[model samples]
Target: MLIGYARVSTLEQNEDLQVDALKAAGCDRWYVDHASGAKASRPQLDKMFELLREGDVLVVWKLDRLGRSVQNLIELINRLHKMGVGFKSLTEQMDTTTPGGTLVFNVYASMAQFERDLIRERTNAGLRAARERGRVGGRPSKLTHDDEVMIRQLYESRTVTVRQIADRFSVSRGTIYRAIEAGGVAQTEN
Candidate 1:
């Protein structure tokens, strides 16, 4: 059985092309999802995976239709292979059931890995450059140590509720609560 999976990033996008291709390729069953590839969760894909059985083949219009990252695509392929299921990509002409297809899969896998490494290297370089310029990265701390101490004192005195204290410190109530939670006995002393 050849099962097809199709995905598009937006709800408004059409799955016609993918669906037609899958059907033309003789897919026994098809699953479609309209969701961002960046997200890990996809209900339709999960269901399709559950329905998969040994000797079944999974087909897709392209690689990105299956996963956002090369590592993720490779992982999914490996898992399906271990389950005695096969994989086929129309655009890439890759079918994991034959030696020729396996060779193509490996070649694609190598390219994907290379692409990931290049992205990582560029990101690291960018971060290093930003650090050298003294441009601090990440969110600024909501409060300094002294501010936390004062917040604890105010909490202990019962002068203000958590929300009121958060407003006073220009932080979230959760932040104030976390500070109190982390302070332990020190908060009560304050």
Candidate 2:
């Protein structure tokens, strides 16, 4: 059985073209979704998956209509394969039930992996360059070194309570405790 799936980004878009294509492709049953391809949840698509059985072929008007990204498309296709089901995309002319189609899909998978590797390499290089320039990522410390030193002194003198120190620094008691701890001050009941 060729169960078709079609999707449009919005309800305003017409699905007639996709419907016609699916019908012409000999789809036995079809489902339509009026949701963004980026969205993981689609009621009609979920329903179609639930109804799919082994030996069933999932058909779509276009590959993009069925997945958000190349990685997502690969995952969906792999999932269908694992279930003993096949996949076909009308626009891309891809059919996992055929040997040639499987080879093409594998090429797509490799390309997606290569793209991911390139992105990771660029990001790491950027991070390294930023570090060389003395630039660090993450939120700046709320308390400065001088502030931590003062907090440690106040805490050690025992003249002010931890609560008082926290109020003076306009920070939480936990922050004050951390500052004192950094200065080798043994924690005591406040």
Candidate 2 lDDT score relative to the true structure: 0.93
lDDT of 1 by residue, 45-155 (tens): 989999999999999999899987888899899889999999999998899999999898889889988998999999999999999999878887788989988888889
lDDT of 2 by residue, 1-190 (tens): 9999999999899999999999999998999999998998899988998999999999998999999999888988998999999999989899889999999999989999999999999999999999999999777879999999999888889999999999998999988988988899899978
Q: What stretches of model 1 exceed 4 Å from their correct place?
A: 9-12, 132-135, 144-149, 155-164, 167-174, 177-190
Which predicted model would earn the best lDDT?
Answer: 2
| lDDT of model 2, residue 20 | 95
The worst-scoring run of ten residues by lDDT in candidate 1 lies at 181-190
Report, for all candidates in order, the number of backbone clashes: 0, 0
What overall lDDT goes with each candidate model?
Answer: 0.90, 0.93
RMSD per model, one decimal = 3.7, 4.8
